[model samples]
Target chain A: MSTDSPIDATRPIALRAVRGFHVGGRPVDLVDLPHRQLATVPGLQPRVSNPNGRYQVGQLYVQQFALAAPTARYPLLMWHGGGMTGATWECTPDGRPGWHDYFMRKGYDTFVSDAVERGRASWAPACLVSEMPEHRTLEQAWDIFRFGPPEGYGAANGKRQAFQGQRFPVHALDQLAKQFVARWTSTGGMALDAYVELIRRVGPCTILAHSEGGRLAQHAALSVPELVKGLILVEPAGAPSTAVEDASRLRGIPHCVLWGDYIPQNSLWTIYRRQVDEWLAAVQHAGAEVTEFDLPAKGIRGNSHLPMMDDNNWLIANLIHEWISGAMEGGMSG
Target chain B: MSTDSPIDATRPIALRAVRGFHVGGRPVDLVDLPHRQLATVPGLQPRVSNPNGRYQVGQLYVQQFALAAPTARYPLLMWHGGGMTGATWECTPDGRPGWHDYFMRKGYDTFVSDAVERGRASWAPACLVSEMPEHRTLEQAWDIFRFGPPEGYGAANGKRQAFQGQRFPVHALDQLAKQFVARWTSTGGMALDAYVELIRRVGPCTILAHSEGGRLAQHAALSVPELVKGLILVEPAGAPSTAVEDASRLRGIPHCVLWGDYIPQNSLWTIYRRQVDEWLAAVQHAGAEVTEFDLPAKGIRGNSHLPMMDDNNWLIANLIHEWISGAMEGGMSG
Candidate 1:
């Protein structure tokens, strides 16, 4: 189960449709550049002046893969973590099928999304946006993603130490880095709004959100609890405090939180874990069914922050499938 | 056939696998900014210093959808135009099945790519890259994409004039604009190299390239003619001069160049059309089989630069499919 076997490339997938679209965001009128020359595309003669018009900004991009005969009652919406795109769920760094494929194969319609300001969810100009974009350096990703100890990356080969049982393909970390994107600091509110819009468009559905997207999923669920049938948060970077959200709104919605190994070792993740635990406790206190899986505790060891991209991703996916099946049944009975 | 009917959402698509990977690009070592505070992520206590390391740069991101059963001899590589990602081929602006789906349904393994410095192909830090990235404004897009004449956009309703027979869904222009990404001017060479690498990995295949991607596709074909089985250039924005590339290298390859309506009215497109025509003449002169489609002349009218995203996109896709089938057959016989 912990092996690095690749997905069978020849396995057939009976898909009903594969399509994509942009959702949410509002149009903003650009009136300031009345006569500004259009020089974006290189080498255009008789430069045309910028026209004052309405332009869309801060939208989300979603790619959907519908199954021919879906067994699951609800669709699965996959939201990637910070500095990543829907590509995160499309394939693993080591070139295996990602969670998007696994769930689709499980006979659930899958919608993988790139949140606002990331990937196909194109960004607004600096003037239109509230803050400048930020990029994650390789050094930062290696450390924050918990592939190794803070000092493991950029260290001498002998000194480099992946958490003893780290399952991330460290050799393919560069490939993983290729999925990182420039994100904005001020788009949290905008992103949350878009997620809610997404749920409105394709819900009541289950949301499988990772890292930064986790908080947005939680907020969206809270905002439209009826539409969000279930929630799965994996190594979420932040969480909504009970003081801020009415956790009781999630009373009937099932919740699952997953954490990989080496969390306690990272200071930032330690804080994040504590925050999420507090929120989960509040949700549980309010009568929501909460299931937590500390992978090491579950004997599924060697997982990195991005367990979906780890060597044993399918094993993890199988576990989640079981949880979803059980959770749906339990919700039905309750 | 030119109707605005949406794709039948429940149509089945059998696939072997859906996955993605990054290709090409060399590692860049960052020697500067040692001990720089890792402040990319906001609000992390005890800021860690940035670790200097080797980072991958200038790679292309490719998403592949392999079919369970294949009738075609080679795959179809879909490379989008400037300011756009592989999303261009995923779904049309008006939410119809794009060329990717059409080609895939026709039994060809399709690889839709986001070139270097675009979409999932991450960008480098300012220090690592040669130049700044450029954003396409809505005004420029409206004119250059040839939806209408220069004064057509931003004019009063009555004053705005779409080409009398424009077929692009003007109402959904904003949705199309949402797919536009910030692109770098200096990455053309890097993009070309990455595309060539992609060809090496999935070669003996056909390339369906649009706009800016057209130049890169031609260059890759010239660089490795044997690998490129066929070529489809859709309203390509630029072309390699015969002086720069020996078009005779494409001697045995089958080529198809498609143009939409209203090319004669736009000055910039006129130049691009002329350049591409020159290259096509040279390619044909070299004993290569070449087919050119002027949609209007062929009775398929009311198209735009992005014919793949136009209202009558299905008709255009049908034309390309017929051309591909004929070209492949011709290649085998000739």
Candidate 2:
């Protein structure tokens, strides 16, 4: 089922610029005197009193990939979902070019970020940071993401009972599984704060938020809708409870919610669907322009929840490109 | 991810038996008084109807592959979805060995049927047939099946937007399109009648049904539960609107409903999900051993609605084999 899809070879090679920065750093003192203990060393040494690393403020990490000869009308900013990092947009488990590269090829200045306390962002002491997410085991992810039978992925030995025609590269299940990280318990507010600050610094840009990142994206949009050129929600974790006033402010920003495969019979997904619906209706009532892409409605089947990592990730990237192009061009179309 | 999955190759090779037969045919009279016309080149060529073919009752066509050394406790009779024939189980659109061969290798005597008015079961005159489905356009199927964008499928030029991670053979989209036939508007009842008769003639057996075939499978089980040893519903289009009484009759049968990928945003599929839910609940309440495989819940992603044709189709087949083996061994288990 392979064909040489048309490639724009003549398109000018992308002139790329890359940089990194930190957001929302705060100061904190290290308490060492309380736990000091004597150590048997050649020289007199305060066992636990010595400072570990330079004491500084905690901040979120941001990586920017700017295309000098950009084709897109607006810069694109991406936020990762829970338990994930900026790597979410970098590459896929199947080793395909991730959304970041795909969009860059299409000539968009792209920025990906690690939320506060995630990835390159230095972790703060438990007291300094807000609620932290518990580490997720491989079993938990396999169950939560519906990878296969409760027995875990054994596709290698054919003990897997994965759905027929499932899109997740069963051959690469373990590779994809390796990407799942620990999710925070209640860092939404802090993440929201950092995201809004990031948006303020970045200026007006189109944002793509996946899963849990959706809450922060919504908060940022609601707080400063003027700076958000567009919002692309990929199977949002949940939407903020919004009033018409909050939503109306987002009228100028075009929004789209894209869902991947498998929602029926799964209670958790059902709830997510309802949340998306409520958000859609709420935003529409406020006169905000919104579009929903029910993949199945368009006869697109077999897309897993994490479409960006699916074998056909490039195809989805194309769809998103079209949507973003249309929205930025003053229309909301698929 | 490419680890060689374990295959029960050492299991005895099946002793196979092949047979063909017709089901539910009836007599029809030829009318000689109809309007007649003469042909210039022939001797009084009459326009009036004459006896056509051999005189036999119209019945569905059944092709059976019986294994002499059957490992499965009961025979497995398969019914294809709407607009399809027994070919649905024969081979995949991508040319891989399909479920029929896979299961036959597992030692299950398999029977595939072309429903009345479909495939080998030649259609009778309108007066003799019950109902016929309307022809579906390529556009309609493309839209309903989510093959790609509204622009339509053109694999030759690579103008397709199949869902990212879709398992469908995009390269074979055109080939698969060529196989789709017209469906009947109200042939469910007639097909059900013939299917029930087939079951009666073949004796008690397990059933594997997809899409529209769900109706006939359900009815056959409900009408004669004794004849249905086990039931495997693969993304059934809809299920029987069975009351507790109707469902209780199926208490002895172990039923499993396996949903493929992507069902959340599809409005049409929402209705289908509801129907499946209703059927599942009713059957469970009736003390029928039932199991629902929500693939997404198990992290088995990227499965299209047609698991049989998916890249991981054999994995799905293995799951069903386990379920059948468990059920036939005197108790229903996953």
Candidate 3:
């Protein structure tokens, strides 16, 4: 009953498919979830559970939403910023609030998984669709995604002080990203499988990430180039210059990374120069295909590391709507 | 009727447009064409000209076919390759045999204007378009498009000795393209204006250029980046690669360059490494918005330059259909 996504016009539809292997569990199948039954609401709220019990993948939880289209291509797997959880994207009861309604109406199967210790769905760790993507420990992963303190910042703060840690914040981001991608591929099927089955089932999926999650998306796309056709990042703190090199390696892969801050007072504005420089460099290498739009426009947010929620919610809704329309139109598997 | 266009479905549509200009002398508009009226003959041979001389421009002619859905956003403006006339595209009497028909049945307004000297609309003296593009030129107008010799193979044949005498082939091509675009824009505010005006009376407008014509389309797109929204090029030739330095020049613009080689002899395998090298290099600069796809396999003479008449014509026809369908459905505008 709310619109927190880019796609919000085609309501009352669902997009479902085999999400992943259920290995020792129920086969994972994701389906379009509606906002509210309107008359009979499905009590499916934020709930945390160890999808993988033995592994202390921290805490895991499932974030569900009704899909707008009956059929979908790729599922948009959302990864919230650091110190945030799935509940960060909430909708008003009237369906004027979250991304679920937006994408559902436009015809995509939407799902948001969260980790523990956040607002909602924090009782459990995020889904491991696979193993711990190569990193032996979570700290290393933290170092890769920029939520870790930037270089030159106090080493006393939560940050990686190893290996030329004296580098500039932007420079450090690239090296950190390399580490994450290296780990992701070494164990996460680097070139093992194309995850073709996943794509065939969902359609042509794209990863949506924010902040630290940006590091993960970058790794996955690079680790499994064949599987990722595109990427949609929101105010991502990607390696300022490294993305250009990273994007170059991607070749045919397309990308839309949004960042920039209208409000100079906002901390996000701090990395604006670095982010833009990196994006422009990537654009030079990849051309119009690898893009960075001026999406400084605010977007949907919740009680989390929120965007300018008030100025952005609708624009975010529009994005979801367009995404659904484009994806569902069929045959743009690229 | 014939299938050389996408203007009328039931009747064998003519490609003639109302051109106030002349060819050599007599009015460009035809009062009576040789093939406009013909009785049902024994063998079945209907010429591809129109009665109204208003369709001829310079050494060019016209062909039109009705689209399946009149609500099409853009009427496809088709320009054929070298040494080929409008008739070369047709297969059967009731139409549906050429690429032009495939698009029309799918609801796209179709029109084909002949090239000046059996090459492209912009060829030789009265060529329809040009292709040369340099940083200086781009800076002159911030060119969004350019046309010229398809990354050529003059080296193999030693065919180019002086670029038509001192004028680099690239420069000559771009100049032709520049003039063509100037005419189109000046006459109707961009080639799509008349087509769009006509279609708006009906719906939207797009473009489809084959072989040499493909180059013209590219040039047109560059001439008025804001005006031309989408393009479909058929086995285009002479796509000069933008050197690394040049690569830095092209920052914005979307391109959908469709390549096909139905014959194995004409396969991408046969494509020169030099051409590929430059293409890739330039693409590196272009980025992800461009979509490149391989066409069905065929032979050595399988390209747009001199596609073996008869069956190979399907290559262009199929491309046109897909291009129009692509533009109409995808609406790759801006």
What lDDT score is found at residue B27 in candidate 1? 72
Candidate No. with top TM-score:
1
TM-score (0 to 1) for chain B of model 3: 0.46
**lDDT tens per residue, model 2, B1-334:** 1122235432433332234445665544434423323121111122222222212233566766555566777788988877666667755666665677678767677887877656445444343435323433344455455455456444466566666677767666533433444344345566677888899998989999987786568777888898898889988777766543377788788898888766774555667778778877888887888988888787877677778777788888888888787755554332
Q: Which candidate is the best by DockQ?
A: 1
Candidate 1 residue lDDT tens string, B20-119 = 7889887777776656433433344535454356567878999888888866778889999987899999888777788887777777889999989888
> Between 2 and 3, whose lDDT is larger?
2
Scanning candidate 1 chain B in windows of ten residues, the lowest lDDT window is B37-46
Supply DockQ values for each candidate.
Answer: 0.51, 0.01, 0.01
Predictions in order: chain A TM-score: 0.92, 0.86, 0.51
Model with the higher TM-score, candidate 1 or 3: 1
TM-score of each: 0.93, 0.46, 0.30
- The docking quality of candidate 1, as DockQ, is 0.51
Model 3: CA > 4 A from native: A1-55, A58-73, A92-96, A115-203, A240-245, A295-308, A320-334, B1-334
lDDT per residue (tens digit) for residues B1-334 in model 3? 2244433334322211111110121112223323323211112242222222222223333434442235466566666543233333432212124454445445455665544322122111112224211111211111111111323323357442221111112222221121111111112123323233322332224666655455455544544444554565555543434532243332344456555343233322244323534554574466624555454332222232222122344444544455444633564321
Tell me the fnat of candidate 1.
0.58
